[model samples]
Target: MTPHHGFTPFFTGDSYISPASKPDWLASALPTLTFYPKAIGVVWRASRQASSGRYDSRHWCESSLNIVRSLETVGCRLRVTGIEQLRKIDRPCIFIGNHMSTLETFVLPSLIMPWVEDLTFVVKRSLTEYPVFGHVMRSRNPVVVDRVNPREDLKTVMNEGGKRLAEGYSLVIFPQHTRTVQFDPTQFNSIGIKLALKNNVPVIPLALLTWAWSPGQLHKDYGPIIPSRTIHFAFGEPLHVSGRGTAEHQQIIDFIQGNLDNWHRQDSD
Candidate 1:
């Protein structure tokens, strides 16, 4: 299938796209053929409910649990441990996790929504342009940052995150700042720690093993879902910011790397 604009065609081969056929036909039909209706429905319903001001944090928590359960029914399993660590915390925290896939975007909200009354994420400004998802994101009041201007973006994060924390909302941040095919220690950043330090909130290190389930493939005929492909969500002990600056940041990064390494090693064994 040839790519047109920002979307890929539904079918491949010369027969499908002839001189007589127009690109608009394929673009219009692709959304239905790819099951976008159902996807959009799910996103819309969840987002609408989450954005509704009538619901309290407890209500959101229950809704998130149901959402995760629904996702699992479709072969997406979330094996979560270290949940007890979060249960012991009495205050708001800045959750730091490695970015790997879109899985966490859906999963993390459900996992932590129940425990924390207010939960918001730091997302790229570009995502705000997406159709239904964008509407939901904005309604949910997430902190959107423009990566191009580092100075303005950092200022926005610190100012917005501090306000959210003060209001009892826990912030979930992808410290790597972007998704990658693989996790590398070198790519990790200390921005999350810096936010925690600035806001005087404890940092909770989260290690997610979620790249295994490749979602929304180009073709449905790719193959059956990979069985025994585990997705782990682990929460590490909270790290409190100390007088140490660079050392503290490095320690947080090392802590996340160590946890991910151990999780992978055990999975391999």
Candidate 2:
């Protein structure tokens, strides 16, 4: 792939994937055993391409999509909606969502990239220090922060996130300090909302049920692939920041809780 200076912002109908049918038990079991190796290979190749300066805008988005599609081969079912809200936005916005499984970290780019070309995450500083994965993540110029020292992390997000937004880059922020299967409204802070308020940008509330990839006993990212758990992602209409971010923060929490409750109920039925 040729290296392009600017990020590519293009997607197809396939990009909004909603698989026709679910996979069988045997098919899902096979991927559970092979997914770790497959993921390593995929990230390694993408790292090399990025290090060589060959991974440009198109390559970046395509590689992410390939990883998500690979999971589908193992019978993972995914549904994404609210692209229309994303398309209507003319400026960069802060995407705030509840942190779920490691699945969202790997799969979200494919869902968001086509709509917003210049996209990056507000990630923990340690993630940018990983072996091959670090290289690929750094190539995208994500805002990195140390989870310790809330004051410092907030400062970093405000400073770095502001610069990125100024350059027309949208940021994804997970307010929960860590990932968990269950959503805790108390743990979901207002960092993302504050960032949006400071930057004078809109906040796009994101709700996702990505339990298809559960946490591993050893390596959290190398978890069992639960193809039966249908992955879902929803983006709410952007809310413009007003006076204090208190109201906006509560609004985001409510949005996430409402969606998660509905999804869980549907799944239980």
Best candidate, lDDT-wise? Answer: 2
Candidate 1 lDDT over 1-269, as tens digits, reads 11212322222222111122222443334422333333445667756764564444444444455544444444444566666566656678888888766657766765666555568888888667776566666755678898777778778888998888898888988867567646777777677777888778888878777754354467321222332455677777777887745766676677667767877787789
Give the CA lDDT, 0 to 100, for residue 72 in model 2.
Answer: 81
lDDT of each: 0.63, 0.81
TM-score for each of the candidates: 0.74, 0.91
Best by TM-score: 2
lDDT of 2: 0.81
Q: How many clashes in candidate 2?
A: 0
The local lDDT score (0 to 100) that residue 57 gets in candidate 2 is 52
Q: For model 2, what is the alpha-carbon lDDT of residue 95?
A: 94
Model 2 misplacement above 4 A: 1-17, 21-26
RMSD of 2: 3.4
| Per-residue C-alpha lDDT of model 2 across residues 1-269, encoded as one tens digit per residue | 21123554433333365557655675655878756676788889989997887776566677777778778877877777776677766778899999888778777776676666478999998888988988888888999999999999999999999999999888999988899888999999998888888889999999999988888899886778887798888888899989888988898899899999998998899
RMSD of each: 13.5, 3.4
